[model samples]
Target: MDLLTLLDPLMTSPLLYPLLAGLGSLDGVLPMIPSEAAILTAGVFAHTGAPSLLLVVVATALGVFIGDHLAYGLSRSVLGPRLINRSKYARRAVAVAGRQLDRRAGLLIVTSRFLPGGRVTMNAACGTARVPLSRFSPASAIAALAWAAYMAGLGYLGGAAFVENPLLGLAVGLALSFACGGIVELVRRWTARRAPRAAGAADPGRGRSPAAASRGQVGSRRVRRALVSATAAVAVLAAPAAAAATPKEADRVGMRSRLDDVVATGAVGALAEVRDEHGAWRATSGVAELGRTRAVPAGGRFRVGSITKTFVATVVLQLVAEGRLGLDDPVETWLPGVVPNGRRITVRHLLDHTSGLYDVVETLPMPPGPEFLDNRWRTWTATELVARALANPPTFEPPGSAYAYSNTGYLLLGQIIEKVTGRSYGDEIERRIIRPLGLTGTSLPGTWPRISGPHPHGYLPTLRDGETHLIDYTEMNPSMMGAAGEMISTTRDLNRFFAALLGGRLLPGHLLDEMRTPGVRGASYGLGLDWWDTSCGIRVYGNDGDALAYRSWSYSTEDLRRQVTVAVTPDFRGDPDHVVDAFLDQAFCG
Candidate 1:
């Protein structure tokens, strides 16, 4: 059943508000109950014409407020002093919390509500420090209400964007909440590390005369009030300044230089496009063909190898959204007896590459020599591909135990799509994604042997008789890479497709969130997507594609505000990765 159908009863029930309140109260002590997710989901469902959004917010805030007070009371009456005296870590933590509270109690309490595990720490520390109940009560109330509004408001944004699917909206809201929490934590760490040391700032009870202690107490209250006002003023002024910032002309020049560096790494041709609030920037370097003076075309198509996995995954998710199939359904449920262990492997295992299936491409002959010329025109059926993989033992005994990239796994996915919808996977991609997004320059060529458009020639370097030869490897049948890496697309079309996909235009927000979730241990791959944490600490999502001589990389920020796509045709052996990495750093962080 669809998520909406499952959530309908909860949305209509009178107990939802009370349930949210109870969860929120429990979360104050446990910090693991996921009250935020519940609140965000309610907010999302409220936008779909169920219970009132304001009532939901009120219920959540009321619960959180009650919970904070309960924690404070318990700590003051029983747990606080005993723990502080017995544990070194507890003492240090409470001491630090006390100092911050002394300076900016109001801000600290409010901000801690949104931070996981922070609310408990701050409240316990405040109780141990014996802060006035009058001061703590007002801050706790404001923090509870503010946090409720912020979380629900994010859900409201997602709901507004995808009114047809409130569950999707909830996913979007959750993703946004995580991103915000991460940013806040990073800032907190940075400030903590850089905070200046003040002279005579030790605790008054530790190293101060009675006269000095009395004076310090009076000054602390004045400083706290001043800081609270200053914080509010700074927040108001900073918003406009941040919004005014944009990419400078120097940044474009730097990016162009980085593109040249890509060609310098022995690529015959390279092209890149970067999109942001300022606009799109296009750059190119090297030649269109061997021994030619013409530069690579600004708009050119290339065979985007495994990047096709994203397109295939998106289609599978769309089908799941339509209630056509379940992600956890066994492969054998759809295509009986095709895989030796089909019953044990799930659709999610295939999409996330944890199916333990052998990668048939490993068995294929793909030498970088003259022998490749003979097999370039050969085509293999999907059954033949799966059979080749099954001939080998499984990479691991149980499915979903480990991640092993298998093109053969996606090949099976293509077959499953065909069985479920009674149409080719390419047709579904065309109907659901390509046509809807107007991707004029993208196509799934079955056995087509040539790139049909304005494109640079691709080459592979081979050593024969102690000398290198640049083989013109542009034209080749891609059927061998069918369902996994056979699609052709331009950088512009790719950027638009990914932007739309990440911007919640293509699939339900929840499905996209699942696509972004890492499936196996110690792996960065999320379903079909690949994410990289850049040198500047910004996370971007996209996939890299590679064919015989063509290579491409596409990535975008979580908000879809910054995007980049780069592709290159090789001429010699060199590290093209250096170019891709440098270009991305310059584009997003310059």
Candidate 2:
């Protein structure tokens, strides 16, 4: 076979079948892959009627099923462990995941097949939870069969349509893309809504973890596994300014000036936009860690860390308005496998951090390696992280008994969202929150590294044995965090989103009130919002985010009359003190 002859399309006619199969497999690994296109093209080739539609459908399903599992397993082995060390919050999230897996084993596998951004590496979720291959494999096959059949059928229909009218094929393709995008958006919102309550802290009556509760149950299991599978870990600050914040007059232009110079110099390659009660723009500067790209705007893009909780809470309350899940309902009512005492804690408790799930992070065996210090080269699975959290005993207290910022709380809520909605967390977010609010620049990043717009440089000071070493904080993949702190976004979008949420656009009035209700001695939580009253009498609601080298935030007044978003890349050095400070001077020039 001469090289030219082999390259000839006519000479390679028989290669189409396997080639088509490969495309389906590719989509399993890379969610964005065009499995539909490959099938459609294959259908065109099937004009000769050689490969029957059934055979093609089987091939596509098998390829996708196998590829998805392979990727999932790789996530467990390669990605999950590394992610454990990425952030303290991430470690905590893993703990809740463990309990959820134990109880909702069956549903977790099924949901993976239907959800977007979820299917990409679901194998790892199942694997890390130590779920047997026997369980996941069959469910995965059945689910994939349905998915492949639907997609293949569409391809067939489109093929027939294309022969009659090419426009119809194009229209069908557009519809599928829209459907995929819509579904993704819906999952995002649902996940966001549930994030603040992931640990099942909302229901104090339940004593077993979601993972523990889920291992055995299916319709309800689907809800449990879906919710538990998506939620991530936790602790959060109450307000931007605590008693620790040195109270000062609104005239802090000097401090604001210093922070701006730091950002302009790229010493801190990011800035926070804070507006005083009088509505003045103030700047706090820092770089966004991760990939240190200097071309970031003052309002740059970053992995918004735990601040995502606020968004999730807002969406949950909105759902409450629609009566999807009631605020007072026991989390156990919606998600079956929640910790044993979960019935005692209401959704309200989980959102308020009253749940007393164990602090999984401090207990887990921290890997003894330089990877902990490196900013970029780390990965982890939800299950591994959860296991580490559960390695130690849970908090001695009962649920809703006291205030603890365990990441497990949020994981519980994530499970709740899916159970009540019959949708993935990511899908719910897109359909309910992001699309409606127009937060175009935000996403659940999962494993995709498409931070397309301009962003600041984020620094992660690598430490080896308590000293600074090489900081490899560049382009770190953020997948294993799941819904915890895994969202990528811009300050501009954050500001807009918070504005919509606080202004009463996102939720009904009563639900919004419930969302803002605080508990657990009011250390610093209001549903999903982290709150503080500035000395200037400005009541601000927002959350602080810290993920790896990136620190980002979005805050606004309860009235939505004022808003701010800050993105920063930490130097891993001096005080990360008020990343939100620098309230601009009350400079409304006469």
- Each model's lDDT: 0.70, 0.53
Candidate 1 local lDDT, 398-517, one digit each (tens) = 999888778888889999999999887876787788778877667675543555445678775544565446667776656678788877788888999999999999889899999999
Indicate which candidate wins on lDDT: 1
- Can you tell me which runs of candidate 1 are displaced by over 4 Å? 1-249, 463-467
lDDT at position 28, candidate 2? 64
lDDT of 2 by residue, 1-590 (tens): 64223434622466665776677777766767777666665554454354677777788788878776776565444454455446565444443333333232334444544555445545544444323344557777886787677666667666665555556765775477457657754664565456432211121111100000101000122232322222211111111111111124345545555455434322345555545465535343432333332233443455776776676676677678777778788866876554666577688877777766664334322212345433233444444555565555657566666776666556566667777787646556767776676555565544433232344444444335554432434344454344455666666668777777777777777766766667766576768777776767766777767554566556677766667666655443333334235432121111
Off by over 4 Å in 2: 1-258, 261-267, 274-295, 364-384, 465-467, 584-590
Best by TM-score: 1
Candidate 2 matches the true fold with a TM-score of 0.56
TM-score of each: 0.58, 0.56
